[model samples]
Target: MLNKDCHHNCNQGNCPFAQDSNNANRYVCLKCGVEREINRYPSGFGSIVMLLLSLFIASQLLINWEKQDNQPQSEPAISSLR
Candidate 1:
């Protein structure tokens, strides 16, 4: 069985895995010696994705604005001369 799942059959108040004294992000199973790391903050991958998404949206808005600005205005119709 996986060390992470070691507590599956453990009692409600009892678990084999405990936090490592040196690292708060690590959890070790006393029975199997398996370790896992916890991530409190997001990774750089998420930041990169958000940055790209925002840039895409900003570029689209700028393109639409420029199109509106470049469109020609309607001219008044000239009356027919007698």
Candidate 2:
């Protein structure tokens, strides 16, 4: 499946044979004339989810920081001598 219009052994993402599933059995690349199998990019959903979770935590921290900054500081009250 990665054998579409390839001439050289280009291992870039633009390589046509990167996502060829049925070719998993094949050791040769049809596109770039290489004996190596084309590399494929994996799904990104996991990384995206992690990124969103981190962003949410960071925003919560920022909000808390702002609240603390806006609150007035109070001094300790003096106790009367016994």
Candidate 3:
């Protein structure tokens, strides 16, 4: 059972009454009792933000790796026989 906060009339037998499953966006219709997936954020802004954030983190890691690879290594100390 979801929050049941929806308060819209079913003009065409499509009023969302309950969720189809737990942690799912699909909802059951009130008039016809049909399960339908709902996209509350159809713009997909969250996905875009996550993608950008991932790309930024990946780029930072790559830059750090390249810097480490380009650094010059120290020469080993040699001991001379007395």
lDDT of 1 by residue, 1-82 (tens): 3545554544343447889899887887675666667865658867999999999999999999999999998999999999
RMSD, model 1, all Cα superposed?
6.3
Candidate 1 Cα lDDT to native: 0.75
- Model 3 bad stretches (over 4 Å): 1-40, 79-82
Q: Which run of 10 residues does model 1 get worst, by summed lDDT?
A: 6-15
> Ten residues in a row with the worst lDDT in model 3?
1-10
Reference-based TM-score of each model: 0.51, 0.42, 0.45
Report the Cα lDDT for candidate 2. Answer: 0.64
TM-score of 1: 0.51
User: Top lDDT: which candidate number?
Assistant: 1
**Candidate 2 lDDT by residue in tens digits, 1-82:** 3445665555464444343466663354455754544344334866798899999999999999999999999989999999
User: What range of 10 consecutive residues in model 2 has the weakest lDDT sum?
Assistant: 34-43
For residue 31, model 3's alpha carbon misses the true position, in angstroms, by: 17
Clashes of each: 0, 2, 0
The candidate with the higher TM-score, 1 or 3, is 1
